[model samples]
Target: MTTSFETLYQNLQAAVDDELQTLLCHHQPRLLWESMAYSVLGGGKRLRPLLCLLACEAVSGKWQPALPAAQAVELIHAYSLIHDDLPALDNDDWRRGKPANHKEYGEDIAILAGDALQTLAFQLLSDPAIRRPDVQVRWVAELAGAAGPMGMCAGQVLDLHAADSVWKEAEILDVYRRKTGALIRAAVRMGALAGGAGPEQLQALTGYAEDLGLAFQIVDDLLDLTGSFEALGKTPGKDLMQDKKTYPALLGQAEARQKVESCLLRARDVLFSVPLLQTGHLLQIAEKLVHRET
Candidate 1:
């Protein structure tokens, strides 16, 4: 029997949502909690969490063991989004078809909520339910490295400055790798690591993720031009408005799309080169995301 990717995605998404609610709800200071929940529970494709779970299954034939890691990645993603949409950052209102968190709540509350969500991610990864002390340590290190200075943070800073500057392809790629690719690669790596993958298996999956990550970012840039606000569940053309550096901005639509295809081809080839990877869902996800409007 073939596993339905949409079904698995829905199921995993529900599980992650439930787990996040359980972990986040019922805390003190109802307003702060509400803001945090608002930021996370706002609808968006749970891509990072799904990648974490599916990568674990691909390596070990089980996704359940990586649930906590899935939640952690999603939380980290939510935190990033909350801050990304702030006044001093991307500076536009509306996320997921509604007001951004800072707009819905006050900026002060939104900032605190993002901070809390960031810490909550570590809390999820460090919980006793993870069942392995060393694994907990490793996940903590991986996620932190991915989200911290040299990874997503650095990318965002570089992107901020580059908004008003010109960047070559390599420089643009560096920002994309750090800003978007780092967490994505980390999500896959943490999942595979949780599944106890051998070094070769880890290396292969990492390669696939690297290529997939680039494709994902390029697609995001494409969607900004091609997707409707209703379809994207966020404002489109923000990139153009800010004059942000992106593949489409630098490479032209035809070349940027070609790059996306090239990246996807390499991603699949890396998966093919490795043996013993039950990564059908991962492959499906790459194809789906390449064509995704949201």
Candidate 2:
């Protein structure tokens, strides 16, 4: 099953890469597209898009139909990362083992690239090939709500406050849900919806995504303190240097590790409740994401 999953993942990853490059054409303004391409084409796991396709397969057994939705989520993710690494934000210079977009391109170009990526995401969903206006509207709204001011943006605001205030566990978790989990939830929800999931099935998958998203963040928190620059593909100790309130900071290494384990188990149990024959991939993804070293 693992070997089969690996093969399937590689196939799907290749398809996403191809379509992503095809999405942005070589147009009159060369620099705009170039800056956007720099970060989107740069190396990363493509986890959100893969999760969307996998969720679709679990529901409909036809991931290909959900490919555009998968692409949309990835574009939104790429845009968020670009903005997150900007000087006014996280102020990081490295991403996916390369210079951040703002550094390689000028800050002005990087900002515009991020904007283009964000709007293009909606453009992809709005494609007539999707064949359903309602679904298109829902997808556009889903991605927007997840990435918009009330979602990831709201989380960013809370995170900035973490630097100055000592936070309770709940407070820190609130930030994680907004900063990391909202888009993850939207990815799974959009995929399942595209796959024609019923209410109960959608509920189950949503529960799974919420738990897995929290676990993913906790693991990232652990990695930031213990992982190396090479393994992480970016500076690892920024959280500490920035005095960012993270799970490890509040619970310590042992407790934080245990928290991740609990979340993963809950995610798995929630996934199991979903009546589907093809949930093996989502289950594996939850385990792999939480247990990943880099």
Candidate 3:
């Protein structure tokens, strides 16, 4: 029987979680590990890691070989969230329905935890167990590029600047591309590369990832406005409170939802255009992201 998307997601999430738990258990210094694990093991969608695994499977690569990369992306994602919630950034008091790392563990510990997780991601990528050195090298570069100055960090910088001024549509989109979409695109590409996908297939996945990323941000904007604290696991209406530039701020709620639908359709088109072995899970993921209540 074909595995359902929910089943596949649950299995992959468990696998990634186990890997993180094992890694943390072996690390020295109990408090540091505890802080890192607190943010990592906390409730999350695990979307980046899941996308990595699914992309690997879609490219006919054994997903097991890509597990390290998947884990690495999640680590980077978790670290980003930790830092993003700091007072210097978004100043969020809660995440995933729990106290923010900074609030729960104090600002200093939270900063260190984020830094440690970021470095650990690179460590995971460098592990010799992940198959070919060439693939490993590519994975390292892909992930670093996505998470560093050229991608997510740059987006954060843009976000900081935007707080002081009104942003154009293009500028907001650029922030979305780098801040949210870059790592997601890298997750898909890294998985495909690990699976030995060709240039054409990689390009298709890139397009699909980019659209999905935009849809994700748009949905996020919608949720911040329309969702509740119970559903989002974080404070609602934060965007408006912070005066952050968002799709809903620029396009309005109905228009933002419409935009998400459009982006999802385009993403689906790109995903189906490629000759993937199994794309149902990816399609479902895209749909869930676009229409998610939280």
Q: Which residue pairs in model 2 clash with each other?
A: none
Whichever of 1 and 2 has more lDDT, that candidate is 1
Off by over 4 Å in 1: 1-3
TM-score of 1: 0.97
Model 3 has a clash total of: 0
What's the best-to-worst order under TM-score?
A: 2, 1, 3
Per-residue lDDT over 1-294 for candidate 3, one digit per residue giving the tens place of the 0 to 100 score: 145767877898899999888887846777788899999998799899888988888898467767889999999999999999999999899999999999988999999999999999999898887558999999999999999999999999999888788778899999999999999999999989888888888999899899999989888988898889999999999999988999889989888888888998998898878688877878888887777777
Among these predictions, the greatest TM-score belongs to: 2
**Tens-digit per-residue lDDT, 14-55, candidate 2:** 999999989876675999998888989897888899889998
In order of appearance, the predictions have TM-scores of: 0.97, 0.97, 0.96
**Which residue pairs in candidate 1 collide?**
none
For residues 1-294, what per-residue lDDT tens digits would candidate 1 score against the true structure? 136778888898899899988988757898999998997887878888888888898889998888888899999999999999998999868889889999999899999999999998998889897679988898999999999999999999999999667689999999999999999999998998888888888898899888888999999999999899888878899999888999899989999999999999998888777674586898898888887768
Q: On a 0 to 100 scale, what is the lDDT of residue 250 in model 1?
A: 91
